[model samples]
Target: MRRKILGIALILLAGLCLCLSLNQADKYRQAEKTYDDILEKYTKEKKVSKKKQDFVVDWKKLWKTNKDVVGWIKMDSGADYPILHGDSNEEYLHTDLYGDYNINGSIFVNADNSRDWSDPNTIIYGHRMNNGSMFGSNKKYMEKDYLKKHPDFSIYRPDGCYVYKIFNVMVVEDGTYPYTYQFPDKKSYIEYLSKVKQYSYYDSGITVPDARQIVTLSTCTYINHVKKRLVIQGYIRQIREYKGMVQKRKINILEDNAFSKTEMEDTNDKEID
Candidate 1:
C-alpha cells in the first residue's frame, strides 16, 4: 500500500510540471498573436513598392489605439518592429501595445530621453526572448561574420529615415557608464565613447563624432554570474528624405508661397536627425 501511494504521488508531480510548461508556452503564443494582429493591420493600410523597397508607417491607424508609438526600427531584413515610448520606461516592460500582459515586451525607449530624438544619446531597451521575438537576434552581433553581414540598421520617422552604423558591441555589467545618461560636457561624452570603443570585442571601424546623435540598444545578458547587459552602440551616418513611387500633387512655387509660416510649420514638424 505504501509503494502504491508513493507511485501515485510521483504521477501527480509530473502532471503539475506539465501543466506549468503548457502555461508558459501559451503565454508565448499569445504574444505572437498580438504582434501578428498589429502587423496585419499596418501592412494592409500602407503602400508597398518593390522598386523602392520601403515600408512606410500608417500613422493614422497606429495612433488611433496607442499614441505612444513614436517610430519604427528595422534590423537587416526580417527583424523590423515598431518602437514604442511610454510615459514610464518600466510601463512596457511587461505590457504590449494593446495593453496585454506578456513576457515579451515592446521595444521601448527610456522615459528620460526625448521622443523627438533631440537628446545627444538615446537608449532603447528590449528583452532577449528565447523565441527570437524581441532582441533575441541581437546575440548574433557577437559573431564577427554576422556583424559584417549586418553592418547597419535604419530608423524610420515621419519626417525622414536615419541610418546608424554599428560601431561598438560589448557585454558589460548593468548600471555601468554605458547605460547612464549623464554627460556634463563634450569632453566627457567623448571620453565615454572612447571607453566603449576600447572595450569593444571587435573594431568595427565606425567612429562617433560630436555633432551626430547616438543610439544604444541594450539587452540583458546572463553569461556572467552577476547581471550583465549586451549593448550595441551606433551613431547616425546619414539622413535621407523618404520618397515613394506614387506622386500625387505637384506644387508650383506660387502654391507653396501661398501657405503661411504657421501652415508650413504644422505640415512638417521639424525633428532633429
Candidate 2:
C-alpha cells in the first residue's frame, strides 16, 4: 500500500522519540533522587545533632523547640545546593540565581530566600566555597587567627539545633553595600549596623540589640578577581533548647536555596519519576 503506510509512520515516530527521552530522563532522575535523599538525611543529622548540642548554639533554646523549623531545612550536606525559590507562594524562598550552598552568587535581604523558619533577618548568601565546600569556611572569617579558630556553624532544625556565631567578619567596598538583609528603618538599620561594625573580624561581644533579628552570610571575592563581596555575620543567638520555644515570626524575606552533598551517593542510582 504506500510502503505499508510509510512503515507504520516510521515505527510510530520511533515510539514517540523513545517516550520523550524517557520523560526528560524522568525529570533529571527526580531531581537527582531528591538530591540523594537530602544528602543522606543531612549527613546523618550532622552527626547526631552535633553530638547533642554540647557544641553549643543557643538560638533562644533552638527556636523554642518544635515550632517547626522548615522541617530542618530539607536535609543533605555532601553539599549540593538550590533552594532559592525552588518554586513559589514565595515557594519557601531562598532565591533562584539568588542563592546559597556552594552553588555560587547573589543575595539581599531581611533574607529568608525561603530557608524559612519563620524568618527575621534570615539574610543568607553563600559560595565562599573553594572546594572546602560552600561558604568554604568563609575564609575562616579572614584569619584574625582564623577568626579565633572558626567561631561557629551548626544548624540542624528538624525541631531543634542552632549555632552560627561568627558574629561578624568583613570586607565591603562595592560602595558600602551591607544595609541588605533588609532595613527600611531601625534608624536605617542602626546606620548600617554601625557601618558594619567598622568591618568586624570578630570581637563579637556582640550587640545589635534590635535590628529586629539577624543572619547575614554573603560571598564572592577577588577584588583582585576585582568584584568584591565576602561577608559573614551571625547575629541571632541564645535560643538554646533540647525542647521548646521559637518566637520571632513576621517573615516574608523573599528570594533563595538548599539540600545536597558530595558525589551524591554515586550519581544517585535511578528510577525517579
Candidate 3:
C-alpha cells in the first residue's frame, strides 16, 4: 500500500512540473506575438533603388505608443527588435515592449547612457533566452566564421540611422571593463578599448579610434553556473539622416521657396560616410 502511494505522489509531481512548463511556454508565445505586432505596425523597408534598400522606422508613431521607445536594432542573423530606455536599468528586466510583464524582456540601453547615443561607449542589455530570442544568438559570434558572415548591424533612431561593424566578441565576468560607462580621460578610454579587443575570442581586424562611438550588446551566460556575460562590441561606420515624412516635407518646401527668391538651407543634419 505504501509503494502504491509513493508511485501516485511521483506521478502527481511530474504532472505539476509538466503543467508549469506548458504555462511558461504559452507566456513566451504570447510575448513573441506582441513584439511581432509592434514590428509590423511601426517599421517598413523603403526601396531607394533597384540595388539599394533602406530600413525605415516611423519614430513619431512609435513614440506615441511608448515614449521609452528609443531605437530599433536589426541584424542579418534575424535579430530585430525595438530598443527601450527606462529610468532605471532594472525596470525592463521582465517587462515587454507594450509595458507588460514577461520573461522575454525587451532589449534596452543602459540607463546611464544618453538616449541620443552621444556616449563614447553605449551598452545595451538583453536576456539570453533559451528560446533564441533577445540576444540569444549573440553567442554565435564566438565562431569567427559566423562573425564574418554577419559583420554589420544597424540601429535606427529619431535623429537618423547608424550602422556599426562588429569588432570584438568575448565572454567576461560581470562588472568588468565592458560595463565601464565613464572614462576619466581619453587615454584611459583608449586603453580600455585595447584591453577589450585583446580579450576577444578572435581579432575582427576592426579598429575603434578615438572620438568614435561604440555600442556593446551584452547578455548573460550560464557556463558551469559561473556568473559571466557575452559581450559583442561594434564601432560606428556610417550615419544617415532619417528621410521620413518630416524631412521630405522640409525638402519640398525649401525647393519651392528657392524658385521664389527665398534661400533656406538645413545645416543641422549631415550624413557620416
Candidate 4:
C-alpha cells in the first residue's frame, strides 16, 4: 500500500510539472501572437512605399491625441501608440486587464528609471515573443555576424528619421538588471555609455563613437527576467525632411524663422550618432 501510494504521488507531481510547462509555453505563444497582430495592423496602416522607403509620424497628433491611450511611442514607420507604462501614469511597465494589445512590461531607455532620451547606449526593454514579433525581433541583434544588417532606426517629433547601427549585445549583469535610466550629469552619461560600448558585439560601423544621445528599447526574458537583454544599438545617420523644418533650429538653418527657433529649442532631442 505504501509503495502504491508513493507511485501515485510521483505521477501527480509529474503531471503538475508538465501542466506548468505547457501553460508557460502557451503564455509566450499568446504573447507572440499579440505582437504579430499589432505588426499587421501597423504595416497596413503605414502604407508601404518601396520607392521612398519611408515611414512617417505626425508629432502633433502623437503626443496630444494619443497621450491617454498608448502615449507617444511612435516609430517612423507610421506606427504610433501610447506607451503603456505601469498602472500609474508615472510608472514604466503597463498591463491591460483584457490581455490583447496590452504589454505586461515597461520600456526603459538606458536604465529603467532614467528618462534622458539623449544618452547614448540607451537600452529599451520588451518581451521576446516566440512569434518573432515586437521586442522579440530585438533578439536578432545577439549574433555577432548577424550584426551586419538590422540597423537601429528612429523618428523624432516634427519630422526626422534617424538610422541606427548595431554595435553591442551582452547578457545583463546581475547587479545591473533593472538598468537605471537617468544620470547625474552629461559627463557621467557619456562615460557610462563608453562602458556599454565595450560590450558591443561588433564595431557597428562607427569609429570613435561617443555618447551624445540615444534611445534604448528593453524587454523581459532570460532567467528571473534579468539575465538576457537583446540590445540593438545604432546612431542616427541622417534626418529625412519631407516638409522642411517648420520647427527648425539655428544650427539646422540659414534663415531666422519660426522653424529655426523651434529647431534650436528642440535641438537637444538628438540621438547618438
Best by lDDT: 3
Off by over 4 Å in 4: 40-53, 56-122, 129-134, 155-160, 174-190, 201-205, 208-211, 219-230, 241-273
Residues 66-98 of candidate 4 have per-residue lDDT tens digits of 332232344332223323323343243433312
Q: lDDT of each structure?
A: 0.73, 0.46, 0.78, 0.46
**Considering lDDT, which of the candidate structures 1 and 2 is the better prediction for this target?**
1
Q: Which runs of model 2 end up more than 4 angstroms from their true locations? A: 1-3, 19-23, 30-34, 46-72, 75-181, 187-273
Model 3 clash count equals 0
Query: Judged by TM-score relative to the true structure, which candidate is superior, 3 or 4?
Result: 3
Q: Summing lDDT over every window of 10 consecutive residues in candidate 2, give the lowest-scoring window.
A: 264-273
In candidate 1, what are the lDDT values of residues 1-273, reduced to their tens digit?
999999999999999999999999999999888888777776433344555455667867887878888877878624566788999988999888787787888988888887876565789888888787788778889887888899788777766667787888988877677786546655666667787776676787777764355788888767756667888888876554555422232211112223111212211212323
TM-score of every prediction relative to native: 0.82, 0.26, 0.86, 0.60
What is the C-alpha lDDT profile of model 2 across 106-191, one tens digit per residue? 12232234455344345555445444344554665566666565555545444344544556777675335563554554466566
The residue pairs in collision within model 3 are none
Highest TM-score model number: 3
Tens digit of per-residue lDDT, candidate 3, span 51-83: 988787887898888899899999776579999
* TM-score for candidate 1: 0.82
Judge candidate 1 at residue 114 and give its lDDT. 77
- Clashes per prediction? 0, 50, 0, 37
